[model samples]
Target: MTSASSAGPRRVVVVRHAETVDNAARIWQGHKDTELSERGRAQVQAAAPHLAAYAPSLIVSSDLRRAAATAEAIAGLTGLEVRLDPRLREVHVGEWQGLHADEVRERYPEVVAALDRGEDAPRGVTGETMAQVAHRAGTALREISDELEAGETAVVVAHGVSARVAVSDLVGLDQDVSDAVFRGLGNCHWIELVEAGKSYSEATRWRISGWNLGPWNV
Candidate 1:
């Protein structure tokens, strides 16, 4: 609600990549280079056309294959090239990368408890905090926002956590409280945000017009 003018608000459609095998097994995929599961491909097939209908001027994605695959699906329909950016990668969960949720809980109860208590704790003992993830992911999002021409939309395909955290950061939510506000984006689901005029602070410069949209929930 920050921008009053019609022309200044840029449309950014942030899509989470489809599910991966690791995701199906509830394993942490942080920085893991995993391809989309079969269902993920089906999800992309279902959602890509809807995203392409936005006629985005740019299609950017995390370098991870799952995100890249989703971006490519939309790109194929729009004739736009997918731009890979490592900065848009998922939060790195360190040694917890290959572990399932229960395994993590059993191995790192304190860390899990800290997070359960809403602390911005480091993941997997040596991994990055949500704030750290927000820094890099938010920077990438802002850059994408700046790259769009007036009234042009851009589609960014990213991992679930990265997409949520980046959007939360841009909209001025603290890492500690963001989780309470935003759940992980469903596979191939998307959030649509409109840029407020530059008059607002960075924390409030983005306004979410739609969130968690997809064939399943739209």
Candidate 2:
């Protein structure tokens, strides 16, 4: 991620949704809308105190259940209302949505190739392209930035891919940088960003801000 100049204390905390059954099964989980596992619940609770410290002025979440549940906890802790935006949902993986990565390679080679190319196209099944998903997320982020410009500290609860891509755009990371960092979206992970003069800036510049330790149980 590249750095930019900023003038205010406007902060944007982007987080990945907590763990879910898909994660436990090693499935793709994109657009599958799975609920969080029991351990996932604990992870959310564990993040509460840390998030509360931020005392966010606004909280935005993906419309998906897993992300919503995670964001709900942050909202409860920070005493902020969480707003749901469907556009912030994870990229649809079509036929690969609920399949394990191996399964995708074994059963849907063509789709797998599409995924590798990072090209937005319809896979074996109906799914939105990477470009489509990225565009939606980028738009959502701009909305969040606009909110920040109006003087609000925001926390955005979203999926890993969407978050990664959005962060890539914000930091102007090239495909290689984005792909390397986006090997996978860390569950309940975070990246801190602040606004500068006319654009948003990243605090760490190129790294994600937080990590998840398996439901916070370990």
Candidate 3:
């Protein structure tokens, strides 16, 4: 349980990958390596300039195509290299992958309800638990932060659920209460985090200075 205050850069900007075909169709992607849709590309393009204004010291992204593409757009704008990390990938949904939202709702209402309540939803065979995803995401973020200098900002481009979980973990929101504390980020939307204190035992040592800042608004 490494805390955000224990070891890391002082700041981070986390962004959700642009939309994909699966996103528009309400289908589960779950590490399926889907590409960005045309609209997704445009969304990335729209966001690049706004993100570049941050002058991120590093740009990190999930290895999945959609996230990679989004990171690439920002990299091109900022002239920073994109570092791909598989650990930042979305939660593996296993049996739920490729299923429509309605299908999942009808087939796994209880699991869906659990997710809505920020509880550990049952991962079907071969899938990952939310706790598993959060652990990996937190570890990856810590590693990236460790490589950064204090006050330097790193932009992390990842999937929606993974980004939310990472932010929740960084802010020390309990897993069972995370849903009440955070909301899903829209495509190309981002949140900003800043270091507030130095105690690993205190979750309040980190602060979310910004939430869900969309490119259109910028």
Candidate 4:
């Protein structure tokens, strides 16, 4: 585990997209580009004031509709344009994309069990490995952090699984052990990562200052 230190960026708030219809149905929506549900829109709207209090200088989002919509809500509040990045998208679930959680559990009990036990399991035959998602998203976040001047902040709206993986990597957890330390973010929830140093080199250190913050938390 990385030690908590006051060294990194002023703050990097990474948010999970708001709820969607798939979420309401407990369906696996990885990379499926579902739009926000009515509750999702409300969640985003409710979170806007708290997010605005963070005073983020920039907003970045996955190009997927759910994430994009959430980012747009915050952007509307902050008057910041959202920069879209497909690399910030969710993990692709391949054959399991539209399956409900119970259905997946029944069909792939062992795989689901492994995941519940904090072990890595395949999402599907052609889906991305967690390590791959972590690498790409982590790299993107590093680039974003590298560009920020001191005391600047940015909000990154992404999906639950990818956000957890990226944050685990950012804090120096290896992929194998990442799950033990990082848990999934709830819809419209966010985590704040603070840099442990001013530099953004490969060896940069970070500490999670906040986790799973949302309107409810406020």
Q: Which model scores highest in lDDT?
A: 1
Highest TM-score model number: 1
lDDT of 2 by residue, 1-218 (tens): 22333433567778888889888888887777799998788778877667667768889999999999999998988778889999889888777777787887899887667767766566546877656777789789767866654334688899887887776666566645677555665787676666544335244332333433233432
- Please provide, for model 4 over 1-218, each residue's C-alpha lDDT reduced to its tens digit, 9 standing for 90 to 100: 23323443467899999999999999999889797899998999899778878899899999999999999989998889999999999998877899988887788877777777766566765688788899899888878776676667889998998888888777777766656655668899999988664445434467787889888975
* 67-179: candidate 3 lDDT, tens digit per residue: 99999999998889999999899999988999998998899887778777766755645689989999999788777766666557899999887888888887777766766
Query: In candidate 4, which residue pairs get closer than 3 Å at backbone N, Cα or C atoms, i.e. clash?
Result: 7-195, 7-196, 7-197, 8-195, 8-196, 8-197, 9-195
lDDT measured at residue 111 in model 4 versus the true structure, 0 to 100 = 70
Residue 164 Cα positional deviation in candidate 3, in Å, after optimal superposition? 1.1
Sort every candidate by TM-score, greatest first.
1, 4, 3, 2
**RMSD, candidate 1, Å:** 3.1
lDDT of 3 at 124: 49
**Regions of model 1 farther than 4 Å from truth:** 1-8, 196-204
What is the C-alpha lDDT profile of model 1 across 36-154, one tens digit per residue? Answer: 89998999999988999988999999999989998999999999999999989999998899899899989999999998888888888899888888999999998888777667899
lDDT (Cα) of model 3? 0.83
How does residue 131 of candidate 1 score in lDDT? 85
What is the clash tally of candidate 2?
4
- Indicate the TM-score of model 3: 0.87
* lDDT computed for candidate 1: 0.87
